[model samples]
Target: MADNVIELHPTSRSDLLARLRDELPPAWRGPRIGPDIPGWTDPPGGHIHDLVLTGLPEPLLTELAWMAHWQQVIDGSPASVQPLNQFAIAYRRACDAGHELATSIQQIDWETGESLLNWYYTTRWKRFPPANTRFRLRAVFHVPRLALIAHCHQGHWWELDEWHPRCDPRIPIGPREPHGGRIIPAHITQPWLREAVKWHLGTQLEAGTLRWSTIGQARQLTRFDRWITVAFDDPCDVLSDPLAAPAQAAEFRRWAADPVNRAMRSCDRRHRAHRVHPRQVNDDLRAVAELFAFVAANTRKARAVLGASPWSAVTALHADAWRRQITPIRHQPMLNADHYVDDHALAQITAALPLLALPRGQHMLVTRGDGTTVTAEGFGDPQVMRMILLQILTGRRASEVRLCEFDCLTPVPASTDDSEGKSLTRFRYAQSKIDIAPDTILVDDEVVAIIEDQRRWVRDRFPTTTTNYLFTARKSNLTATKPYAAGSYTRLLNKFSDLLAIRDSKGRPVTLGHTHRFRHTKLTRLAELGLPIKVLQRYAGHATPSMSMHYVAQREEHAEQAFIATAKFKADGTRIRFSRDDHDAMHLFDRADRILPHGWCMLPPLQSCDKGNACLTCSLFATDATHRDVLQHQLDDTTALIDRTTTEFASRHRRPMPDDNVWLAQRRAEQQALTRLLDTLPTEPGQAIQGHGCPTAVTEPVPLLPDPTFPRRTRP
Candidate 1:
């Protein structure tokens, strides 16, 4: 034999045949019942040729091809002893698993092929370890059936009618029972009703019509199902029966409304109780109504058995059923800024994140607790820290932040060289909540670096995995290429928070226990900066203007802060009395600081200054009617300087100075700046700057050059 060519040794081939013969029963070896077939040949030299799969229908042929491909994969992997004997051994294993092997190959159908494939998986491949392992095999079986396509991934099979190409493979198959049997109450004991509920949810999940992130749907319906069973003293099937649905729904309303009865708490992740919040009542009722709709759309037998159409039961309830119930539905209150991370706190966290990327076992002070605090030894993996940073920096929800893909981060078309000052980077991500196309978010250089680091980490650790996710866990239980699932990411965040004992600004232990709160914090912070409602909508990926409005709500405190840039203070730390006029003037001083030559700045204090300080010609500059005199004076000065410089140059150079002449150009730039500034001065009466401001207040917030013990007060 050639040195490079791999051939099965005679001794190993004999041993492989012996092992194959031992795994199969005598019935497979005895061919007395039918005509001869390739797979049915004796185990001593039993072989399956590629020709055995010929002359079959397309579906069967493809299935057989997949089986053949899998066989080659397994045989080539490190687990197989004799590589040349792989096909025969797989054939024997298939027969051992009870796939009926007709003696004639021509008689085999797609059903027979499917049965053989399933049997082979159950008997051998599922439990087969790569004992001799050269390389791992990742064969995804796309088995097509009459109604839907069956997806076989990592040895498990799931029926998926529709699949998103960009979906995270880490997402586990939807439970045959919705929410892993948690949302459905156990008391509703009718088997078919339970099955009907499962069918609707599962079908929706498989069809991509329902989202796993929307946990409320299953919980609400499950609560309704339990309530109907208890209140009506009837089987679950009664809900499907149109005549019984109105009464069933009415009884549920009574049960849901009764103050004495315990409110049903959601069994999903949040576990929110139906008590107190009117929103829960509305959601639960709406959920039940939606369940009825699903039943109407899908289940014909259940519809027939229920006597009325599926929607009959849902429509029977009064349109104001939520208000009529014991608990009246009310508008859900918008979120406030309290949930957001304070600027100081965000700075502290950002500073700490870089240290997290250090090699493991490096020591650092994690938290300062009164009794016991976690030390540097308690930090989580660098990947988890990166995830937290992404959340803080981008204000993305946990799902968007965690499932980031490698190639999606890019520079905005208008942006160039991120290393340059003020350049921006943008990331495109698949929006998890809505079915809209990928959305773009602006991020800074730091966030862009984090993303790059994560991509390198994934590539280095899981080199063989085909996953394109930027951040991937090295050890995944599902497949070689599984990205971190939503649950896993959440758990990691919680674990990191608990171990480090990270705290909030109030000196209380602040856990990023609720990740969605980060999204709230981000949008609220942006809104606090007085970003346009439309801009905020795009930044937060909100579906509508109203949704964006919910996050941008202004509080009285925010208004107060905007007006009073700083409070009067004394060096002795004693209270200083100030007049209302003084307080009102301070507000005017704050507005005057950002007054430009074109438009007024309505932005809040916490936001970054987007203006590059070229205030002379920026379109965002604004000057009111009161500034017209000052602007005209500046323009006159500029014109005088231009003429003086031109005349001086003409005398000295003894020739016409070119347009590119440096001194002449400076004079022209000054002229243009003042000219543009003058044009924007308004003629109409409007609010104007009050109090004679010092140079510091009129320009940017430049630090005073000379150090002084106390801050110098600006002369008004």
Candidate 2:
């Protein structure tokens, strides 16, 4: 996170291939797959080389693997050095042929519509908007071959909206074709149509007419076209029915467009109290229509084109199954850098973390009180973020305090508990519930200004929650509640990433990692500081060391620290001598006992001294090897602790009333001072194992928040 960071891009095509070689087996050559990279067929049913060498050499693919590292890091961002879209088209042919990055034909499952969808969408979405994993994967991986079917449905629906004719079905909106067939009209402004197109085109694949039975099955493509063709060819009886009266259609459109009705339908949505998100709504509405049109176009093909198969039997769709087939991606990590980790790209992410100084969260981008998103790596409410970062910055936790709620976020006396009026600005919210998540608060001075300014911007646009997005209209068919799910943080992040022209150290675009890398870097820094893993475990609200470990990444540093501290003996059975100054600076004490310098040398089933915790027989006790092992183990333990604590905290934090004040008090003081107290701490000295003992620095008590198992306080 310091300024001494390096970028990870302009990668060597040759080097990447070499690197990839390590990823695969020795003597590996062809593409990973069921089908070799597919190329376009010659005609109606033409098939070309299953795997074409074409003009491209292996190096380009290697460069692309590197490029994708940057691309995915930036959420599928286009590279400034090269236009990926230009080259990405080449991958499409392979995706169309049902190829993927997996190793064997056994790794494939043609029967899984979703798997097909992943291959289908990743290849295609790689071509355009909302730079992200979805787009990149859709560009090359999660394409939803069922997408064509989903599209066929969306397109069909869109066509019908126009085809049905608002005025009269017989009256075409567009000019007639030379053969006198009804043609789509020009200049018709049905906003709904646009919404539908976005949905159909976007990665939200609605399998519409081409429903798949599962996520795996290799020989399933044979049945796909048949199912689509039969459904398309089936005579639509509704077309024969008299078209709705112009007045009746107009009334339906009006009802559909009503904001009140849309809001009503979203009654259970936790964020309904917030207001309608016009862009999200319009996007959804238009998508629905586009999906219908997409469906129609593909299915309208000839029955002869289908060729009889199990797919042909799918003419009748069960509406529920059809709907279920289309699911919005449910994110687990909220933000994932797995694509960039361990590769050169990670350096940039680490650098960007401190530079952005955003809260950390890899999952749901944290929301600030005003509905602005935090650019962090790990998820948090704004207040929790302020507290955690405060700890990171100051290296101290609050001694005592309480979290309180006002009608809305407002500044109050920091000493409200006393009459001192020595004020700390605290933001409050009612306890969050399943139906209504907590509103966030901003406490950091730097972040508070940004949050307020962003809020003002939002206010200028909406004025009131009832007014909705000033930039857009909350039209019919688009529900208001969807934003809470997709998250304002995500939407806003796209805009911010674009505005900042931020790039990871990798020379790829930088967008999605946001505040997440910050969380990891900060946690790693904490581990380096020798903050007891238990302290970090509580600070992070984790249940165990493993869970907390995700945020702490510098294994080498921890090992080095432990190595120098514990390993100190000579062949003469005497301890290494240290000057008084060295002893004081590094915390060394004289003892007539054996020691291990680093825990690294310990074999599995490591032995411990007979004492309560091992003092001797530790690899750290040995001066022969550097004490890197103990530091590594310490980090691993801390990581586990933080991960466990955060999960428990998130769950308990969301729960309603607590019958036990003891449980509530444990975290209250720490939460209140988290933001203000952290700034006073020192940056880690980055020490390696040296001659040592306990220092005066140890005298200051570190406030510890217990993990999920909040221990009871004992009498002094």
By lDDT, who's the top model here? 1
**Cα misplacement distance, residue 247 of candidate 1 (Å):** 5.8
Each candidate: what lDDT?
Answer: 0.50, 0.33
> What are the per-residue Cα lDDT tens digits for candidate 1 across 501-585?
5555456655666876667777876776667888888888877868876755454434433443344444554333544233333
Per residue, candidate 2 scores C-alpha lDDT tens digits across 148-195 of 112223223333322212212232222111111121211223332233
TM, every model? 0.52, 0.25
Minimal lDDT window, size 10, model 1: 142-151
TM-score: model 1 vs. ground truth: 0.52
List the lowest-lDDT window of 10 residues for candidate 2. 397-406
